[model samples]
Structure formats: C-alpha cells, structure tokens
Target: MAEYITEQKRTLKKILEDNCDRAYTVDELFCKMQALYPSKAPGKSTVYRLITHLVNEGAVKRFIKDGERKAAYQIVMGEHCDCHLHLKCTDCGKLIHLNDKISDELLSTVQSTSDFSVNEEATVLFGTCGSCKKHSER
Candidate 1:
C-alpha cells in the first residue's frame, strides 16, 4: 500500500513538473491522473492529500483563480520562484516565470513610487501569452 501511494505521488509530481507552464484545478488533476493511468490512478482524496503534501513542501503554489472561488495549483519553477513575480496566460493558462533582472527592476520601481509593497510569491500578471496572441491574430 505504501509503495502504491508513493508511486501515485511520483506520478502526480511528474504531471505537474512536466507541465510547469500550466495550472490545474484539483478536478482537472484528478481527471488527468485517471486518463494517464486508468488502473493505478489515485482516488480523489488521495490526489488532494498529495497536493497538500506538495504545497507544504513548497514544491507547489496554490491560488484561487480570478473570478472563481475554487483554488488552483501549479508547480514551483525553481528556487527563485519566490523572488520573482509570475505571468499567467489567460487564454491558455500558461504560467511564465519572469526573468530575474526584469522582475527586480519592476519591483524596485513599484516600491520606490508607491508605499504598497508587492508580494512576489503571490503575484501573477494575467494576459494573453505570445502563442495565444499569435493564434488569435490568424
């Protein structure tokens, strides 16, 4: 049983890491896991448990999607993720890690001009990604 649970956790981690650019709701994750391994897919509760574990470990970021109450999860890109703001594609749900230099400049500018401090870890700019913008232009 422990081995099966560990396997399921590994599978879930792979799914999240492989698609680092996208965020997934719990239901979506559950469905994807089911689709990938019909026989070995973890149950909904198990998926939730694994997600909780990942979030606690700082390997995942959890946030509520815009205009929705349910939360979404995405894989943390690297050790630097906490130091930079993120960009999310509204059209495709892709998450882009902002370059460090640019992020620092932006944050510095905001701090120098306004009294409000931005939380890099929780902040995400939403817009159409380059690929989605190109597709729409066609």
Candidate 2:
C-alpha cells in the first residue's frame, strides 16, 4: 500500500513546486506557507519534518549555500534529481539546474583522471547568474 500524505505535506509540496527555480530554508518556507494559508498553516517543526521526509523519499533536494546558517530545500521534478548539477546565484539566491552533456563529460573526465567520483545529485556550484552579472555591470 502507498503511504498517506497529510494536508500539510501536500501544501508544502505545492509551495516547493510553485517556486521550483529557487530554494527556501525551513523558516522561509514556513513563513510563505503561513502567508498563503493563514488558517491552515502548520508549525515550523511540522514543515521541517515534512521537508525531511520528502528529501528521504527523493521528492526534494536539500542544499546549503556558502555562509548560510540554514540549509535550503528545493523540489525535485522528473529527471532533475539525477540528470543535472545545480548552479546557485550568490547575489539573488536563485538556483538554476544545469542539464548539459558537458557536465557528464566533465564527470567522466574527473573519474578517469583523478580516481574521484562526482556526486551530481548533491553537487552545487555557486556563482553570479547572467542577470546578476548584468545588474552588477550597470
């Protein structure tokens, strides 16, 4: 039998899906959840637990940005959980998924040359995005 999903979990999943381009810390997600459904908002602990469960179930991805105190979570849809590396914008905190054949070639090269394997599922590269770079240039 399939496991049951509570209303809180469903709401959290929806929020994550709606904001697929970015990640959110537990506190941030909690605040947004509360804002979206004031009367039905779950507690912070509940949101955290649900997110943890989703991560375990391979339904979400968790990452920690440089100098960040808390980890952020993003929803994993379709092949995104396996077929891509994540690029995080340091300025705007946007997370972009890069699914290019070049990434696979780089992974292969690393493994062949250095005897080290890249964990693509959890790998994140931090840099300024194109929009951020343009904004800074102006």
Candidate 3:
C-alpha cells in the first residue's frame, strides 16, 4: 500500500495552515491528501485513522450540516474560543464569522432568561446578505 503521509502529523499541520476557514468533509480531505501525494494515496482506513487522530489532538474540528452522514472538518486556529457568532445568508448561504463582543447585559439576559449557556462558536444567525437583500428588493 502506498503511504501518502511520510510524516502524518506534518501533513495535517500543513493542511490546517493552508486554509483554516475552508471546511472539508472527510472524503474531501482524503481527496486533497491524494492530491498532495498523487503517487502515494492513503487508503480509506488510513485516512479515517488520520482524521480521528488529528481531531483528538485538537488539531482539527468537525461539524455537521444539511443532515449529512459525514461531518465537515477544519483546522483549529489559535485558542478555541466561544467569542464569535456566524452570520449565514439565507438566500446565498454565505457565512461570515462575527467576532464582535456582546454586551454583558445581553449576554446575561440570554443566560438568565433562557437558562442556557451561549456558545459563541456554534452561534449562527441566518439573514439576507447585503447584496442579496438589495437584489431581492429590486
């Protein structure tokens, strides 16, 4: 079997560094690994193992979308913080990560009223993007 990853850890590091925001499915990531080493593609088992290992190391992140069987993966950058919310466009589905801090009152009100902890990392609000809104009105 061809070994695509000579230094497996380094490969993961490079991929994360290359595109932190670009989310990729495991299969997609496997395809990318093949591209990185056209002559030595990792097998399915190897790919799964690598992904699992990376996730456990906190080097990768995973999320589910559209009720898919597989989760999307991205590289973890800096300290994992719940200090942002994602703005997702309802029309185009374009997503932007918002890093603006929330006022203590609002945060407190949400916590106290809802009796729930707010996770900034997974907080995604859906709305029309500026371009989409303008286009729609016209």
* Candidate that scores best on TM-score: 1
> What is the lDDT, from 0 to 100, of the residue 91 in candidate 3?
63
Q: Which ten residues in a row have the lowest lDDT in candidate 1?
A: 61-70
Candidate 1, position 137, lDDT: 85
For candidate 1, the per-residue lDDT at 100 reads: 79
lDDT head-to-head 1 vs 3, winner: 1
Ranking by lDDT: 1, 2, 3
Query: How close is every model to the real structure, measured as TM-score?
Result: 0.60, 0.57, 0.51
Better of 2 and 3 by lDDT: 2
- Candidate number achieving the greatest lDDT relative to the actual structure: 1
Kindly report the root-mean-square deviation of model 1 from the true structure over all alpha carbons. 6.8
Model 3 poorest ten-residue lDDT run? 76-85
lDDT of 1 by residue, 1-138 (tens): 498888888888889888876778899999999999999988899999999888898788887664467888989775467878889887656578887789989999999999668888889999987877887788
By TM-score, how accurate is candidate 1? 0.60
lDDT tens digits, residue span 41-129, model 2: 88899889899989999888787744476898988663444776778787756678675686798888999999999998878889998
Clashes of 3: 0
lDDT of 1 at 86: 88
Q: Write the per-residue lDDT of candidate 3 for residues 1-138, one digit (tens) a residue.
A: 235453765675577557655667778877887889776667767777877777888777666533356677766552333455556666644455454565335566798999977776656788877767887788
As a TM-score, model 2 comes out at 0.57
